[model samples]
Target: FWDILEQPPGSYPEIEKQYFGTHVSLTTDIAGDYLIKLTVSDGYSVVSDTVTVSFYYENVAPSVETISAVYAIQDQTVPLDGSGSYDPNGDVMTYQWFFVSKPKGSNAVIDDPLAEVTSFYVDVPGIYAVSLAVSDGELEGKPYNPFYVKAFSLLGAHTKLLVNEDIEPQLLPYKERFVVDKTLTDDEVAKEYVLGRYTIEAVGKDVTISNISATDHLNLIKPYFRGWSENEIVVVKKGESLTFELVSPPTNGKLTDLSFSFAWSLNGVGDFSMQERFSAGYDFTSR
Candidate 1:
């Protein structure tokens, strides 16, 4: 018999035991920690053992989080982030950014595809498709669906459209863009929520994001693994804290919730554009 320590005794929903008597297959929408106890006894003797399980059920592929459209000055170096990519096995490791397409007649290119963090310089005014792929080391992960980053003539335009891009697919930056594919949690601490932040460069100019707040209603699903099987499937669940800051605080500040976008106009180009990109939540321990 099995039981969840936090749940009423005998409240363990029936689950199929795996090949090993020590392991079991759980089929439930619930996600969290469980402490299972096993006891065996003959008429004359008895013995017992216990195991604590930090469990979460998720069914998903590695995903990338990022801004939809990026704006940069032609011929100038620009950073791209792919660090937001994630895997369930705590396996996702390396980040690889690619350009699905380049502007016609453009000679722009990403500095290094293998490097976790990289940059690029575009010399033409056109839309380019940029994508990111992650690896769990043993296997390569999926690339974020590609997004476009517009480039304008460096000396010609002081301001340009700040395209309202979606944060679905992040590439791989600083005031400089950032891809926090890494997840850090403090389970030791008993805190209600976990907060996170990222640095975003103002699209049209070199302004500083010293202190600003934003919200990301991004649909982030947390993933978890079971057993030690190399080929085992991953479990996923929709959860985690949203509403992060635009810029990582130089110091800690109580997190606040709000939905907004950053608006800016280019110098020579008088069109206005808005974008809202936020950092991922650090804690994934199902609420």
Candidate 2:
């Protein structure tokens, strides 16, 4: 478009300015229908063009919202999410996650700092702080609310089952009586069998001992950890050794030369099975 001025219309020469490359800044204290032009210079040649910035509009800034806190167990994989953040102007946003604070001496790292959902693991128990930032095409929002994380420890667990020895022989298949019994005065050595039992010790905190079962009640027995306990859950705490006793859960005592084995399991942070075995029968030679 051409405008009329005091100077010759062709002689006003379309007020022009040269920009070295792709961009040029135009500042105007006075706004009106003024002519502005752009030109580029290479060592060998020149190129130029013109465009208009309408006086009616302006650019606006964007903002982000606050995130909440979390609590979890130590040695656990925890998630830090920034998907709650939103841009007011409906501009597409990108996210950046960071570990602003962690346990002392902690070198824990977020699995992916640039992702909307990142994760980290802390073996040390303590409070931590994580932060997130949202970016519009032009600028990043400032001072976002950080997420506070609380990590706590899990108690350790241990178990032990042992066979008891060093007592009267247990392989008593049948009760025996002495031959010295007479009508005047009956003399007899009473035949009896005492089956020995084992004690299973459960040690740990927030722990349960269940699934107690035995391979055999009469022979080759490691206590059955497969089916025992009420609903198979027993809470055992650290420094507290919970012991359960099994005295041959009422089987035929006459089943001689039998080996009995019992076994059970423990879980959480660690997995283990406790086992023990002992034999029983009648010692006929002693008769």
lDDT by candidate, in order shown: 0.47, 0.47
Runs of candidate 2 exceeding 4 Å displacement: 1-62, 142-144, 156-287
Off by over 4 Å in 1: 1-60, 155-271, 275-287
What is the lDDT for 278 in model 1?
A: 23
lDDT of 1 by residue, 1-287 (tens): 55444633344454576323556665543466666677666659878787765656555556666455765556656677766667766654777778889878988778998776787877787778888777666666665468577666644433322212333223321123223321244333332222333222333343212122234333243111111122222121122111223222111222222232332232222234443222233322222
lDDT of 2 by residue, 1-98 (tens): 22223232333233323323244444433334335455555669877565554332233445655444544456667766667667766778887777
- Deviation in Å, model 2, residue 199 alpha carbon: 28
Total clashes, candidate 2?
36
TM-score for model 2? 0.35
Q: Residue 208 error for model 1, in Å?
A: 20
